[model samples]
Target: MPLPDLVRRWQPGWGRCRTLPAATEVPGGLRVVLGLPGRHAEIFALDDQAVPALAERVAEAAEPTWLTVPTTRPGEVHIALENADLEPFPDAERLMTIELDDHPAHPVPNAYWAKTSEFRGVHRIDLTGHDGTVAASGLAAIVGTDAVMHDIRTDPAHRRRGLASAVMSALAVTATQLGATTALLVATTEGEHLYTRLGWEPVATMLTATAPMSALVRT
Candidate 1:
């Protein structure tokens, strides 16, 4: 699919995956009212050309907001955001996707137990340690034929144990069982290493900017 059309399909599922309000389409892209501390809302620009306008919009707002643009050249997007008085966050994330059929099986490590559950339309998996502590976890939400994955993470104390991979596998199984054929997620640079190993391909780099911390403090 074209990147633009892929983004259009991806955004709403992302919001649903996070249980956030539906995204609203505006002049440049889609906006979601996040309303969290240090984050009042966020706008996902359709492309680089939309970044400047979205940056300017956030710059004039009293509430802290984030602007995320998907592009290969984050340096240019960073410069445009700086020009608009927005602070660009370092280490751009990757927008990744995979055909569920291509995802390989990763069994839960012998030391951990995997549990999958669903609530409010979101499917969740938890990898609990042998001692019963939660070691890693992730969630997926099915939207039509696609499944959006969110917040797949392992505890700092549990690195290098294949727990993260187990969490991902469990979530994928749940999503596929629920009739989803594709999977998508925004992954950190560190995460890209793991997803790529699991057959997910990068579609674009995601550059994010927010109001400067100093400015947010006064709001």
Candidate 2:
């Protein structure tokens, strides 16, 4: 299987499992997301299962707009949206390393991220220039079943100096050593270019819509 397909198959099963408002099902080798109340629904297929009732329920709840299915492959895996405007999904076009069971004994080396509480359980690699001040950093998490690469950043003064590449390479090497087969991230346009140059490939485009907390709360 391609790396993207492997990663997609692993997601939802191995990564975060939450009882989201939306429910999921598999019918006829398709993965489907049902009962999403907004202008949209999500669908994908990973295996074979019958779920006509679930599809009927979703169709009943859908708005008048045509269903939008964003997929990496037609009829393979897709996200369906109802009453939602079609927009480009935010994605990065390069490949990063995915580490499955890597636990680094050494501590993370970046100080800026160290101050934040969310930095825990994340391993990092720092890139230094000839002067030795940290120029860039790559951070990644390798849990038992899931791996994630987050926050690849370079200092403002160090832009265009290749520090990002250096740190990302360091992170990838470490992730490979740790046994991760796939790395995942949401990338910006510029970052996507860099990642592709470094051997990352785009797998799927993602689209998202947000509702404010105030809207969710009854006025």
Task: Give the winner by lDDT.
Answer: 1
Candidate 1: TM-score? 0.92
- Model 2 TM-score, 2 decimals: 0.49
Which candidate number would show the highest TM-score if scored against the true structure?
Answer: 1
> Model-by-model lDDT, in order?
0.84, 0.45
Query: Once model 2 is optimally superposed onto the true structure by TM-score, how far is the C-alpha of residue 122 displaced, in angstroms?
Result: 1.6
Instruction: List all candidate RMSDs to the true structure.
Output: 2.5, 8.7
Deviation in Å, model 2, residue 200 alpha carbon:
0.8
**Angstrom error at residue 145, model 2:** 7.5
